[model samples]
Target chain A: MIKKGDTIPGIFSVLFGVLILAYIKTNEKMVVMSADTYGGIGPGFFPFVCAVALVICGVLLVLRGIKQNGNVDYFQLTPERKENLKSVVMLAALVFIMLLAWKVSKMFFLCLPIYVFAVNKLLKRSWLFTILFTVGMTLFIYLLFRVGFHIRFRP
Target chain B: MSFELLMSAFLDLLTPSVFLYMSIGIILGTAIGALPGLSATMGVALVTPITFWLDKVDGFAMLMGLWNSAVFAGGITAILINTPGTPASITQAWDGYPMYKRGEGGLALGINVIFSFVGGMISILLLILLAQPIADFTIKFGPAEYALVALFGMTMMIAVSNGKVVKGLMLGFLGLGLSTVGLDPVTGLKRFTFGNMGLQSGIAFIPVMIGLLGLGEVFYQMYDYNKKRAAEELEARKINQSLGRVIPTGKEMKKWMPRNIIVGLAATVIGAIPAAGGDISAIICWGNSKRFSKDGENYGHGSAEGLSVSSTANNGVIGGAMCTMLTLGIPGDAVTAVLLGSLMMYGMTPGHTMFTEQLDFTAQIMVLMVLANILFLIIGLATAKISAKLLNMSQPTVWAAVGVLCIVGSYCISNSYMDVIIMFIMGILGFFLKIYDFPSGPLVLGLLLGGMIEKNVRTALIISQGDWGYFVQRPISLVLLILIGASFLFPVVQGILKKKKAPAAE
Candidate 1:
């Protein structure tokens, strides 16, 4: 069976290389200025060098990936692996909820509790415990940040 | 440098508000560390903004408290559950979880706490006494030396990548490239902004960190959801048994103390080196302890010696990392890098000069670390038994909680909608990466150190009038270069030697 890890790096290396090349091409006008008094190097110099290094390293990685032959199937996305997809969706939805809460009302203290509740329900935990945890966490955050520190949670 | 000034500085750090904040930090730190996937770095980064309005020493103390406590608490989850709380605690799980399964969870936790405290205290003393001298030595580094340091750090990525060297290097380079996306420091011109104003500041470390480490793991956890059903069914069928009394006996303590102290000292020294972190120290110490074990076969079983060595080494890195950050402006890991940024933001540049200029703030942070370590032991021992119950919680519920925290943490970083979006996308990417066996640790480390490496290299070159020889001319830089070369080559060399020796032994 192919391992998922080997394939991930191969894809990342290729994507990283493309990104580096694109960055260099788009920012070609930027150039390093000769060093002067008061201590500063031109902005373009470091980026250019860094980009080239990335491209080189990335290429070497891709080549190595191609040469490796054993258990490459580990990286494959099978139906069995599809179940793991829920984590991604749930995480994305949570981020969306948080953003909506932040934007809609800074006082959306509902956001945290809803999140905690959803998790508790998913974990097949008792409603009582979930509610208690949600309330406890929300109150803790509210007291600590808003009441104690006087921080405003602006949208 | 004056005695009166030092006294005043010490007095300032002892204020009631500072103590309160430190206490709060320890409590929060332990809570977060006890949770799997919530790390010290995340806790500190998330809480750092709260200190913006406080005096510098108070702010520093709160951060120190969190950093010190979080490192120790990470092992609590690992010991109780088979799940490692942080990457640093993974080694602890090799033996700790087995002990927990054998109904020795309490003893394992107690030993872990005591050794963690001892390790942290020793490292802090080392920091207080040796930081200035180390700083003086580090000042000699030039651009080439920084490049070497980055190189050395990159090599460690292979170790963290879990047997994939190429992928680790690729991720590291990718991170370095990402660091170049903002305005260049020398010319003040944009490099890879692509016309977006947000890119002007480069990828925000806080958001990227949250996405990669926090959200990414959540995504990976989702894959196990179905299998979780089987696990739940199995759990239902199994009888729930209470763990017996959880304290270590004197005989057990006597058996493990000498090994713990030796491993702790070794780990402290390793962690104190710039660029090396707790994860590396813990893993190394664990490996060394196993090699030196009288009953090596007992390892990966419920060996108290195994748990003690790993936890002590991991916690030891906190104080050691801080020493480098305070004295040399060189952060040992991502969290300290953020702390370093906070220090600079407060107009306190760390270096040999910081000792003379901000004696009290420095002393206060050190003292806070020492106190926090003691407090963490107390808190950890008290809460270990209760927290272990979390291991029995349903997987779905754990995921739900993690998902919520991930979103909340990302949003809290900037309170911006765009940041949440970024976090979501990054989290998805991180999930895919994890599934494919790509190590996020190297990538995070790369991004964390990328800016430092670039800016320092450019600055050193600028100062040297473009003389590459400047790095080699310094003794410290030369030593660092050799070390970097050894870090990269030693593994390969050792593998070869091991192979050759195997035939001879046979």
Candidate 2:
């Protein structure tokens, strides 16, 4: 049976599978045909088969979801569901911001601890502990990576 | 298998560095493993480079200890916070967390630690006894057999998943599809790089894993500040008047020992497969044990039997994984993949020769596994209080910090920012998977086995000059195919029987 939860995912998965299959068909590199290989099967063969299978599965799920959705309205979101949606959206945005900061600064030492502390603080942790934990962990990671393993982080 | 093997193994254990490095690994492994967003795989991957500078024995001892102990420690979070540190510890959350809620936090942790040791010891013994014979038998294995066996392993995981079989299959097949995005194994041509240099080598599962399990959990828990779990954890901490018994009573121990052995054996067998580990082992064994136990209905509530099975399966898996890695060149899981890479770096190739030529080194690793289990037992017991209390700490701070570690761990894989980006994408994907009730285990396992399946299929085809019959013509492959057919049919038959039985019971 289809529910709101399954419906979106079903559509997404189906579209994704279709797009991948289409890409594989168009990309000549994926299809390797030679006189000296694999039971007439090429690299693209397995992937192509997998994509079609995934699409079929996805279509089944979509049909099930649609049938279920026809009986039940999912427009009303409970507070808990709303909160979950909010939390996921906010985290996604936060990570996007973190990525931008990293790309701009190229300094984990500077950006990582700041966001770590800020996130913890936003979640209602004590400022002093958040700051201390953030700094301590950042230093530990820096030392462990930079000095211990001799891995160089981009400046 | 012999006294001499045992004697030499014990002799290899005599070195102080073996104990010293292992102790260091245990402490680090326990800490990382107890934390959400960090796992045994991450711990091993991070320390692998560091181990290169040390002596071979010390380095390997450290790695082995790190693996076993980290797996054991995942249950700490599972028990304390109802948040599993790894998927391997999910059952611990199922039963152990409930026990903690009933003010048996210490007892839960104790059972987890003790049974984990039990599992480890039992598996190690099996490793010593069976590794050689299994390797010898598999020496005659061909590409067709390998292909069938690997396929069998993946489907077995899906069939045993405590979820909708179709959902598990979908995710698994999708994961296999995703795995083919990189350069074609047989053709040496890029398949789905799409002009990105980073895409050529394919996505490293470690980063993707950290994002999915670790960061995804953090994001999911960000809702309502995870106040519900944090409140329960803190309340459990305050309500405990006594730490209770970290060691089970002798009678209690005797009661569980037999069942634990069965779970341990089952786990060990599963663990020997290159594509399986504690996650699948724990799930299957735990499910089986629950069904047989008198208090089967009490399983998910607060049954010690359920916790014991889960706990035992965790470390019980390591010895089996090591058996496969040492005997076969193939990895047993992501962690063993790292180990295999290390072995290759040392100019050692695993095969029939590894048993004969590298016998000493293999013995050394076995001894190290045995010692590590002992050391962790002592260490885990001593620090159970501190670890149990870790969940009582501020949730915001712990999880927020874990998020950062996830980022850093992904980046540390190859010191690439691209890896971090991949982690984010994977994190989002994993978040959705969880939200949609798709099992992540199958996907991860699929990615691990996908390469083997592709390589073996192409190799067999190439060798047979495009003969479709090559797969079934060989005896081993034929037998393996029958087994694969059985696996797919088993679930359907069971479902039919279950449906038939329900009405009769009514």
Q: Mark the 10 consecutive residues where model 2 chain B has the least summed lDDT.
A: B236-245
Worst lDDT 10-window in candidate 1 chain B: B233-242
lDDT of each: 0.69, 0.78
- CAPRI verdict on model 1? acceptable
In model 2, chain B matches the true chain B with a TM-score of 0.81
lDDT of predicted model 2: 0.78
Encode model 1's per-residue lDDT on A1-155: one tens digit a residue: 34432434555555766666565566555545444532344566555565566566656655655666454554455676664455456556655776677578666576667767776665557879888878887887788666875655665
Candidate 1's displacement at residue B354, Å, is 3.7
lDDT winner: 2
- Give the alpha carbon lDDT tens digit for every residue of B310-381 in model 2: 999988888888887777565677688667656755668665567888888887788888888999999999
Please tell me which predicted candidate would have the highest TM-score against the true structure: 2
Backbone clashes, each candidate: 17, 3
Q: Model 2 clash pairs?
A: A2-A64, A2-A65, A39-B466
